[model samples]
Target: MTADTPAPEGVRLQKALANAGVASRRVVEQYIVEGRIRVNGTTVTELGTRIDPENDLIDVDGTAVQLDVSKRYVMLNKPTGVVSTMRDENGRPDLRRFTKDWDERLYNVGRLDAETSGLLILTNDGDLAHVLAHPSFGVTKVYIARVSGTVTAQTIATLTRGIELEDGPIAADKARLLDASRGESLVELTLHSGRNRIVRRMMAAVGHPVTELVRRQFGPLHLGTLPAGKARELTKIERGALLTLARQDSQASPGPEEHSMQENE
Candidate 1:
């Protein structure tokens, strides 16, 4: 094909978008005419546009779209005592109890200790999974912990300022005391570290032991009113937000190879 020729090797844009559940084929055609769709960062108004859905970056109204229909993303409000592993050798409560209904073999992104419960993502999309679970991406997570004793302003300050642990020094991105009583305190903390039991460890390091902990948010996903032990597929908007986060992170921080190429250039 010549430089000016359009490659006739892929499916029509409208059909591909429709099959990906973006919308009906007819609506996708209208979107094309309205210039609301973009492929590979270029707006395409032609209805005859064909795209390789697997390789092309497609966006609708600036929100990244996941065109692979085979990928499944599930949000589970993991209840305390349930292990994050799909299968546990100890035969205790595990994620398989909740995910067995889905046909795709899904695995948890990152993990939550058996004692700590909150938003857990189960997905089969390896690329997105790696982007989220990898510490290099720095996806933030929010947790609310009820700890022993009253949490003073100094304690909150120390958490954000930094603290030393056995593994290494760690700090919360944000910290605040939600409620304080005579013998207990409710504190909210935000951190991007994926350290094992970091919240519990941090609180203990600061002289307050965490009595109970619940993760309320993970990156763009929230556990809003999701009752414990319930699992549901992510909504379209949630998936878009998640994909946008991953895309933005991947773009902002180039891989080692990309950095090397840039240096050479």
Candidate 2:
């Protein structure tokens, strides 16, 4: 509880910048340490320094930092072969392609692998992003995966029990067979952990290699027939619901597995 204390008059400078859509809190903290941030015309290189957003004049690289109270929350039904990042080094398709016309600076809340596709949230509100992405918050994501082999009830039990990967142990919050009776079958899984390629790894570990995977839901948001590669702004109610979930989850005590997932992610 004593880890961080907000200033009586205002919040941390990095938080202010993050809320204003400058960047993530971690990135804003780096900007603070790198001397790129100035408050009231005075350079500040100390982390956790507080500033009055209403009164203090803040700037980044000499440009006046205007507080953007209007933050954006976007939902993208990402398509396969598109990278989750805003920019890619190899010139591959990225989120910027989908969000190019957006005026607000946005970053992905979590990530979907280039081979995986589905509901992806992009937001300029860094605080909300942190909570959703951070494993400790326990915001569940649901995925429907088509695997190469039939998945049985025993496999579902094993998946729910948990599997040990190189990174850490991952357990599904819930699992069910969506379809079966052929060489390929569909399985639905819900989990809170966000380790890289976790669902693929877990399914492959159970002798069912995933052929296709799509995240159908993230916390309270659902893909709901959203076309692949299309982007849409989150409704105010949807945004509020997600924020409430994140806030409630963050206040709970994190398990050891959650800590491991955080480190690995």
Candidate 3:
């Protein structure tokens, strides 16, 4: 019960970190000695320090490390014409068809309209999902859009400057014209907004309606050569990148209680 006494429960800090894939046990021990690891906000340099992996927050070099081994992160290349929901009330093509292999109930972090197709993350980790899905976290998404008109440099400038929509004003973090020919344009846009049908709307507002839209990247995850309608577990590096992104955002923002108090005032 003394402040100096070690807790009686939980696994050793280095062991937990190693099991979480932070590094090998020996490397984690070195990290501890270097004061690069922290448990529950306190720097933990002792190799024997115990921590409740389920409850304690662990961070390495200021980025959080997810310790829950049961957590699952999956990436899916959703094809066009399939609804984002696992179950659709309208009897339309749904995501369930692509998720049968996962025993754990995984839900999408965000959505792409039925008409659009691209990278989608389905995960059983609620904490990671919340951090990635929430617009306040400012996770950037990349989209490749084919629009029905010639896209000039001026239009790309306008997208980054700002655009007024029905809900409010929005702006792309980055925009570039990939190709413009034969009365059609291929435009790549980077945005942090999670608004519904935002890419399509932005294209229309710019006088070039989107003929086809596909998400190319979400946060640190990219839709590489993964074929459409296929799903796969996130690689070790991919998972680490995602956790780091979530941790960085969560640390930069105020906690819920503090944000709520500010809102009330």
Candidate 4:
């Protein structure tokens, strides 16, 4: 085995928890402080304790802890007006709304605004989440926006060139007007920056200004045919592609739900 791969036997409780990709060191410490861990039928409360995972009996919250080989990934077609959070004191936009019947405990990889809608991915893989949502991961976001005022050829250039805002300069890696009316246009924007309300703020910084913003893609995953308020498991290919994307540097790409129209669109 490579030196980086720890031997399967004689690993410690904290190390096992971390190795199983369960919790961080600080969080596992809290479990220890709460006396929530057990070894060979005895409560383990010491923070410095160690035990072998392969041979020793380990339990957390009275449930045996086993290393997991499979990971769970979920893609939700988030509708506008629902908050994108695990929980809130105001009792709104809790993830339970969409995951009511799912067996897995899923958490959003990142977040979308309550006023925005489109692809929102959830997963039980903390390491994958770190790779997707972490800014340093540089995961790309693809958005479709409806904006006021005509998007002149020059305006599209400003988007490509970058615009300065109170939060600092923001620009799309690439963008184009997909549909246009007299004074409004649907624009597809792709970028590696996942800043808050970035699509809206970016358009406002320029002259067009967004009236409605919807996410169509995040990395290699798409909202696909999933209806709003409903969810589905990631296809084998979807799961494989995400791991593939994580291995490479970032790039602009589309996944799904380019706009928040009825499914017919």
Candidate topping TM-score:
1
- Cα-based TM-score, every candidate: 0.89, 0.71, 0.88, 0.67
Prediction-by-prediction clash tally: 0, 0, 0, 0
What is candidate 1's CA lDDT for residue 62? 91
Q: Tell me how candidate 4 scores on lDDT.
A: 0.73
Query: Which residue pairs does candidate 2 place in steric collision?
Result: none
Off by over 4 Å in 4: 1-70, 249-265
Per-residue CA lDDT of model 2 for 71-177, tens digit only, reads: 68899999999988899999998889888878888999888888999999998987678888877667889999999888899999999998888867778999999
How much is the lDDT of residue 235 in candidate 1?
A: 97
Candidate 1's C-alpha runs over 4 A off are 1-7, 254-265
- Candidate 3 — worst ten consecutive residues by lDDT sum? 256-265
lDDT comparing candidate 3 with the true structure: 0.85
Which parts of model 3 have CA positions greater than 4 angstroms off?
1-7, 61-63, 254-265
The order by descending TM-score is 1, 3, 2, 4
Task: List, residue by residue over 121-219, the lDDT tens digit for candidate 4.
Answer: 888877667668765556777888999987877888889898987757767899998988988999999977756677887887776777887788888
lDDT per residue as tens, model 1, 208-241: 9999999899999999999999999999999999
Q: Residue 23 CA error for candidate 4 (Å)?
A: 32
The true-versus-predicted C-alpha distance at residue 229 of model 4, in Å, is 1.9
Evaluate model 1: give its lDDT: 0.87
